[model samples]
Target: MKKILTLVVLSFTLTMNAFAAQKLDVEVNGLVCDFCAQALEKVFGKKESVKEIDVNLTERYVRITLNEGKEIADEEVKKLIIDAGYDVVKINRVEE
Candidate 1:
């Protein structure tokens, strides 16, 4: 009975996490080179809340996937890009 309960709890936790994750597509300006992509990666990749990051220099966008039940506010996202010497064009919150 104890083992069954533990397994059921673990499964529930995993299911909740899978459904709670969020993705953000942040369009940025002034990303002219590979160095800029690297810079964005460095800044966003270190955060525990960020599960993954994809920087596209050509599209001038950064795709960030936040960990379960975690989020980065619009203001903070804009601030980070501005501080990195880039301009934030738009931020779209994508819920899955």
Candidate 2:
């Protein structure tokens, strides 16, 4: 009975982790046009870890959804955005 209970708990934990998503909202500065948004999307979209990306020019924020069990470090995010000629104001991570 104890073994069965443990198994059930473990399975539930694994299932939850498998479905977990890592979302990152990066507030940026210096993104001026549609072209800039497209460039940002292309840069982040090339990463296998990134599942989806949304660029909001009005707010100057980039939203990135990471694939299951995948992540990009905060420093790397900052570096990439900077390399693309944008300033990183903040990186907010949401786990779901």
Candidate 3:
């Protein structure tokens, strides 16, 4: 009975953490080609907290999915893009 109880609590905790994960939508300038998208993907994918990255060149947007209990600041996002030779035009937190 104790083992079952512990398992139930652990399951609930994991579920809640998944629900608390963060997502970000960022519009960037100069994301004009597949190579540019690949560069952004490589940058964001290297972060341990980043679970997923999706870039749409047509829409000039980058969507980032972060693990639970982790976050990247707007300034940091801008800096990352800038360092990768792009400019961030807008950033917004995506509600889960």
Candidate 4:
């Protein structure tokens, strides 16, 4: 009985940790120029959880990766981009 209990506890702990390590992707809009891309980089760079930020000018999108288990809400991310003088038309999560 004790062994089974220990296994159950371990399993639960591992599952939680796995969920915490999840990552997400986001898409942005109104990034039609180089200056807009630079501005986005500056704003996202200030986020502690932002591990990487890739901007595609032609597509007018920004792909962002956050630290393991950390995530910035779509509204929050949009607000940040908008604050930098750009428009966020959409936000999408990249699936693994």
lDDT winner: 2
- Residue 46 lDDT in model 2? 91
Instruction: Kindly report which residue pairs in candidate 4 clash with one another.
Output: none
Prediction RMSDs, each to the true structure: 5.0, 1.6, 4.7, 3.3
**Number of backbone collisions per candidate:** 0, 0, 0, 0
Worst 10 residues of 3 by lDDT: 13-22
Better of 1 and 3 by lDDT: 3
Q: Identify the candidate with maximal TM-score.
A: 2
Give me the displacement of residue 44 in model 4, in angstroms. 0.4
lDDT of each: 0.89, 0.92, 0.91, 0.77
Candidate 4, residues 1-96, lDDT tens digits: the string is: 999999999999877875563344455656677888888888889998788888888766788877776777878887888789877776777633
Stretches of candidate 1 off by over 4 Å are 1-18
TM-score of 4: 0.72
lDDT of 2 by residue, 31-71 (tens): 88999998889999899999999999988899999998887
Encode model 1's per-residue lDDT on 8-67: one tens digit a residue: 999998888676869999999899998999898898888888999999887878999998
Q: Is candidate 2 or candidate 4 better by lDDT?
A: 2
Q: TM-scores, in order shown?
A: 0.77, 0.87, 0.79, 0.72
Ten-residue segment with the worst summed lDDT in candidate 1?
13-22
User: Which of candidates 2 and 3 reaches a greater lDDT?
Assistant: 2
lDDT of 4 at 67: 76
